[model samples]
Target: MSEFQTKVSPDSETFARNRKDMLALVERMRALEARAAAKSEERRPVFDKRGQLSPRERVSALLDPGLPFLELYNMASYLVDDPDPDTSIPGASIILGIGYVEGVRAMVFADDAGINAGAMTQKSVDKALGAIAIAERQKLPFIHLVESAGADLMRYTVELWAHGGGMFAGLARLSAAGIPVITVLHGASTAGGAYQPGLSDYVIGVRGNGMAMLAGAALVQAATGEAAQDADLGGAEMHAATTGLVEYLAANDAHGIEIAREVVSGLGWKACGPALPVCAEPLLPPDQIAGVVPVDYRTPCDMREVAARIADGSDLREFKPDFGPATLCLQARIMGQPVGLIGNNGPLDPDGAAKATHFLQAMDQAGTPVVFLNNTTGYMVGTASERAGMIKHGAKMIQAVTNLRVPKITLYTGASFGAGNYGMCGYAFGADFLFTWPNAMTGVMGGAQAALTMEQVARRTAERKGVEADEARLAAQRAKITAHFDRQSDAFYTSGRVLDMGMIDPRDTRAVLGFCLHTCQEARARQLNPNSFGVARI
Candidate 1:
């Protein structure tokens, strides 16, 4: 294995510019995340008065100390409600991720009840379903810190109503698949939300704060003229004693989390096998990664520089270095886990696509997990490329990426555009965990190129109609389209729309990839007994 030599210069003008741009993007991400946190913090006083923990505080207390919590989809609904970037916060009113609970790794979902009473919006439902899908696929136990006001009626959509059933179905599937579902009702869980705790294998209810009912008092009265108090209907005490909906009752939020942790500790679920081999740290400082990627994606840089900072010992075994110089394929290790790396130095040419196709098949044959570094404009165009069978070769590469059985992780390091996004295992391709750098952009094509394309179309249409083209109007339209695309292509915009799992700092790339790789590896090794139907309360 040869080490990838460094080509990035810290003092170079490009590096300096990239560092400044990267830092700015990072700040934007941090600001958005802080806004979401601040929104929750605003309710801290109310929670303290009620002797209850905030949603985030509850999550922190639920996980084991000194363990990493990989929060996912933190920007799920960003900029969706309003056009103003300053006011739109995008976490879908839920904090979800993977973390250690009593030494066992589990999927944790906590409703940000402090924000809008933890109302379930369309984005929140999508985020929940994504978490459920991950839990099911990874064979991880699902732990939900329930405290939702159910779906928002004001923003309701028929699509959300149709997809809401998947949440419950996913829960049942997880249980039947032998993955435990545990829930702690931290506060109100009314209407459809009540089923969350009901479907769980283990339920812990906080004595004074917990509430779960198919219909609240007002709703019950409206429907059947039956008078019922909140506590008598579905409070913690009632559920534990009368309905048997809750297996455990705790005095408060901390006690409830502790009880939930204890249940996980008692599950008898042991680690799959021995610890992984010791891995050497990368020779290059990971911090330098900020300068490795050009701030302007059009600028050319070696993708290997990224691999150097993230690969264990900065060692990489290049595959087919000459056959497809643009598409780089290599065998590398991250935290002692063997993985295949696929990255782009330029657009996917016919040869590059062919090389990638072959490389993916080989990696799959070797049963190695693959990581894709997406930084491509797309497949090369022009008559020469078409004559070179670009379409056929690109399709072959996409097919290989689509069919590979190994765990695939994708990182949007730079430009991800055109069919190149698809060929590089974009979100639609279902990368096990797709993460993007703060400076990343994802769209069909560059804003300028798309705008110019439309302008050409408009001009051609006018010419065909024997009318003079309105150059001023065309220019304005092009500018508008370019601005729109530029805004939409931003990492924050894509992240808010749940495009990638979340936007991560460039320096944290290795750690994030290693954590996900370990998770995927564990899931592949863990065995579970499946039943036709999930266990139901008797």
Candidate 2:
């Protein structure tokens, strides 16, 4: 302790001065970065769309407060002859980084349409690939805002294998990693850009700004002589209504960003539980939820209100509110348990199979218990339906539900007919339990439709047998067929192969649901942690 004790501590003034100097150095570096940013801005082209927010700006609005964006490939770009000297603007067309959305860590990448029409350069591809690799390695959600003019033809001329793009390879690798990938289309997303989002788990589009496909109008016209407008070529309506490429159709850019936030929050993040409350509310008045009787099968009812009532506290975060309007899927808490609810839109247009498949797949991965609220007249029909590839699209839902491992509870709020029953997670469709309220008039088809069919059958039989078919008897037969699987009996759990091995106790809906949630919670052992990380996107 001789020499050490002899050494005196530095004076407070000297220490303070050194600390100030270090801070000053940091400020100086920040000023230099700002100056570089300003110089880059000076070189940006004054294009037709100046008011539109940049990708970085959009990301700023979308992410959580106080979180920093670790920009990937910040200095990677064209070496020379680039008209736009704003290096920060394009960042090689793809901006990949890790950031926090709502305090949840996630990987975010965006195709900057403002730069080279968001073309995919080799540098950009590498940046994207690297970002996704990081995301997968870290088990973070990957968000992509794609809006590109496809790959840079300039980068491809030298190599014939350029056609065998490495971009697809990167996407395949990212998909195989099983990281929840979410995409938002804010502008034209065609060819390679379109393919990037195509492989993601969740894809959303803005009504006017979003688009996706192998070819746009100009290319289609050049190749097939098909002149088309933007909407006809690749718009939100085109994808949502026909191709089913977009899972959600946003009302506008703001709507799109909000939807993106929701999607990110709902991603399969095991670090934090859902924010929705699970306490079940008191049963709604009988008048509010009209009983699902035989007559109710043909009648269209607003399933949304029904969903709100069923979800505890009536707070449900409905996904894809606009697109795939026919099928209503929501994330909510029932009796304090995370529940994924899928319902049938009584009158809204079925957005087609692509959306159905997407919804089912998303729900399956969410790892939340599922609730099916059936109310549909089966799949859409006619040329419009065929054009949207309904058969192929809807089949995706069937396959997903079959493959899903979560406990599914079906509540026949109204009609459950034909494929609609299956789509709504019918008893045979792997639902753990199917329950109907006292008003439920369960059947293979609507009694009215059955009545009409019986009328036709009666006429056919009368003509052949030369005898008057008993209309009353025929009516009874129609009722029997309507209630074939589930007779219009009370809500008792029956046995011996009738309607879901017999219906669960109807009056016990509240109790049954609460018990099921408790059982599920116990099975999982997910206790509330005071040190909960809360909802995070990454």
Q: Could you estimate the TM-score for every candidate?
A: 0.98, 0.43
**lDDT, residue 417, model 2:** 72
What lDDT score goes with residue 453 in model 1?
97
User: Which stretches in model 1 have alpha-carbon errors above 4 Å?
Assistant: none
What's each prediction's clash count?
0, 8
C-alpha lDDT values of all predictions: 0.91, 0.59
The digit string of per-residue lDDT tens for model 2 on 280-368 reads 57344212232322223454545655555455666667677788777887777667777887877662234734565676677668777
Instruction: Give one digit per residue, the lDDT tens place, for model 1 in 54-113.
Output: 998899998889989998998889987555798997799999999999888899999999
**What is the Cα-based lDDT of residue 210 in candidate 1?**
96
